[model samples]
Target: MKNIPKVTALCLSIVFISLSSISNAQQRYTDYDPIADFYNRFWSVPLERLAIGKLEKIMLPNLKPKAEILDLMCGTGHIAATLHKKGFRMTGLDGSAKMLEFAKKKIPNMKTILADARYFTTSKKFDAVICMSDGLNHIMKEEGLTKAFTQVYKALKSGGQFVFDMNWEERYIKGWNLRGLRVEYDNSEGIISSSYNKNTRIGSIKFWLYYPIDKAKNTWKRKAWELTQYCYTPQQIKKALQTAGFQTIKAYEANQDLGDARNAGRAYYVCKK
Candidate 1:
């Protein structure tokens, strides 16, 4: 029949579309099992206690005093609080309301908005933009990452810089092996959560959680979920920034300029719009 080939083509197209939709739907739901304050904090163990300090040392030396700064994906306003105290006009943005709840208390004077980095804009452009704590990894796809940098460019004044970080597959393989991956953090409040994720190189680490909401309660356990991403190399990051209209792109190792094992084993990006 004349329609036989057309029918077969339609069936194959439907199947392919269904499979692609399934994969995207899976990624849409992948996120951390929420605890009181832990998941959004992203197990601060990998970063030093002074993450804000290390990051500030990177930018503050070059930043003009009293400049307007935008903190993209500013979880809990950690660094923003410090920068605000230093007399910088700080505005923090993140998609997490749970984290923003904590941030409001920490930096009462700083402004915070709940918005994803890729789609947010402000009435005022900032002199510089920074996203910390591996915030860039959460973007997941190359298209979204490009959109994110483009948004940063739109939000920044000319000659402004956009800085962000993420895990490198190269470094993750070298150090993020499952054999020794465990994290425990808590304050003497009404909560405690300790958890670990087995290693997966393809995209993200599969993570689990055990959180106690109350000290009086015996157990608080939530099952695990996968956080997926297309990991980018240093070259890929620079290329994406360039595509997004960031003219001056640079990469840095975290602690030492040569490549700090903890922070810079992979790298962070500093781009000028």
Candidate 2:
């Protein structure tokens, strides 16, 4: 009886430590639940346009008309909607339920899957798979990146293409270093701040959005969240793609290929399985 208390305490301590470690691991990735509305409303438009333009130039020409396309990390379904209009069958897959809610609302007839990019499987293989707006960067480890590529590979048809963009180190150094970090709207204001750790090759961006709940009472509400991205070298990415059975891989510097000044530190990869 005397020793039972010590054993219970030890088990409790182990459980606590395990839970804490799980939480810490989860914190390494961003949860889009809180910011899904803000992102859908404020941030996705221009980026969607840019991505569409690039896709048209780079990936669309290689596809058959009405090709089956999978939009991986397809937040809000904007790209899927646009491509749907262009005559392709679109299916969106995203990790965030809130983001998928918006996506489903946007395209009532479209199919959206809520699953992690690293492990999602589909009975339907796609003609092309796209992960846009630095989506792959959110996979914070090389193992996760490789797994994501493998899953994408498995989801694609034979000779299918995978197209995605990633942020290079220069993007974090120049863009995320507190540049253009503040914005205001009629009813809300937002501030974004970020940091990049060279040693870990990780970058984190924190967002704070404030909106008025009652103008007469001067009452306001604020929502805050942080997101992290990992920076992988081109060599690392290419190797992972090859390991995932992508034989024909071509990389293009976004600004050079698209002639867009905004894409200075971004690169796009087109891989064929």
**For this target, which candidate reaches the highest TM-score against the unseen true structure?**
2
- TM-score of every model versus the real structure: 0.72, 0.84
lDDT of 2 by residue, 139-203 (tens): 87788889899999999999999999999887877777773377664466767788888898888
- Estimate, for each residue in 45-81, the C-alpha lDDT of model 1 and write its tens digit: 3442445655665677788889999988777666777
Give the CA lDDT, 0 to 100, for residue 246 in model 1. Answer: 83
Instruction: Give the best candidate by lDDT.
Output: 2
Return model 2's CA RMSD, one decimal. Answer: 10.7
| Local distance difference test, candidate 2 | 0.80
- Candidate 2 TM-score, true structure as reference: 0.84
